[model samples]
Target chain A: MDIYDILFWVLSAIAVSCALGVILSRNPVNSVMFLILTFFAISGHYILMNAQFLAIVNVIVYAGAIMVLFLFVIMLMNLNADVEPQKGQLVQLAGVISGGVLFLVVLAGIKSARPVTIDKAASDIGLITNLGKVLFTKYVLPFEISSVLFLSAMIGAIVIGKKEDAKPIAPRDEEL
Target chain B: MPVNSTHYLFLSLLLFSIGIMGALMRRNAIIIFMCIELMLNAVNLLLVAFSKIYGDADAQLFVFFIMVVAAAEVAVGLAIIVMMYRKVHSVDINILNRLKH
Candidate 1:
């Protein structure tokens, strides 16, 4: 295998391993860290696919913004090993079995499908310029709708997360 | 040999499977949320790979939209988790069953 193949294997391995770490780690903080590592590896894959814009965005949005949010929640909750509930061994086994079965099915399907050769030349499809053109021209409606979705999410989060107002209980009239 | 779409597809499938396992097995609500994010990222990887293969920007654009939705989801999901923590004093999903009462 050449450098491209080598890199692909390495990045995918990192991603998969880190993903396992995220699930297996007992501490929530560690899980978040592993998730960040997984995101980084995924960003590397995006780079390999020559999707430079997505690579950058993956790092910035996922690792930067979303992970920090996860970390914040974990820290705010002060989660630790003791408080985390343990799942039954049988359930865990079932989860593993199902996941493995799905993976095998997907692998088999991909292996059986006729391989289509795509042009390897550096394509500008992933570039910001081309992406921006399409985003504004073709997908402008969904783009605006997504903004609205974000706005509603922001409002919902704030409304749900705000501390409840503490009202003093009034004394009973009979007691007076 | 040059890397092809199959390789990328395999990698994404692996990641997505891992994510499914995590979501199924993990008890912590936060970790489960992280697993969901992992699944989303796996999907994003597949979309980018397919975009490269198909020589179109549409799939990549979908990736962008997916990222947007993921961010919004995190915001709302984490808020709900936090709210749950305040009431229950834990992030364990098992404890949430009591909420039915």
Candidate 2:
């Protein structure tokens, strides 16, 4: 119909297709790239929803930071399509069946629900100033706690990922 | 001409389902992790849409919190994956059978 409607359709198509690419692409690297594309499309959807702040943050945190971390680990491991093991046929079938069932159920549920329309354009809730005010004032405790969680996560990642200086014992030697 | 909340809901549902399939079917640990991130993004999209509908900022704020937790989770989760790769020489989840005993 109009620009809003057209944008929504286009972005949703991009997101869903890219999501499929994430799963079906044999190369893990390509899969990561597809995931990043999906994030970008979802961020476009955020912009359409008038959440400008969230749209930016989604791009920054997801496509920018998290995906780069993924890429780093992927490259660090030197993963390739040849090395990725395939699941059994039956397992793959089951996964597809389950996912399809979920989609059908959720789709049916959504079809039955009444659509809520916004009579007016959305307010400034998505702006950085308003979001920051709420984050620091009303939600300050959780915000502070999340920082602590990040700290612990950083420490945990460093500890888990740190290379031990001790000469790595051979697996066979340890078994013996 | 205007997009309704239901439109966003359907989009989120599609993305989430794709994510579930990816997580279930993929053998690579990192790709599975990426699927989880995809699911989180789907939820973020839904939250922003709902916030727009309700004319409120809380849901958007919650999205922020979700993003924070997701980042931390990814950091620790990826580190764990790297550790597993070191031990097993592969990122295939099927190979991670040492804990079965």
**For each candidate, what is chain B's TM-score?**
0.95, 0.94
Give the runs in model 2 whose Cα sits over 4 Å from its true position: A119-122, A166-176
Q: Write the per-residue lDDT of candidate 1 for residues A72-170, one digit (tens) a residue.
A: 887877775546878999999999999999999889888876665646667777889999999999999999999999999999999999887554667
Tell me the tens digit of each residue's lDDT in model 2 across A37-142: 9999988887777899999998999899999999988888888545677999899999999999999999998897788875345567789999999899999999
- Among these predicted structures, which one has the highest DockQ? 2
Docking class of 2: high
Model 2 agreement with the true structure over B3-78: per-residue lDDT tens digits: 7777778889999999999999988889899999999989988888888888889999999999999999999999
Chain A TM-scores in order: 0.89, 0.90
Residue range with the least summed lDDT across 10 consecutive positions in model 2 chain A: A165-174
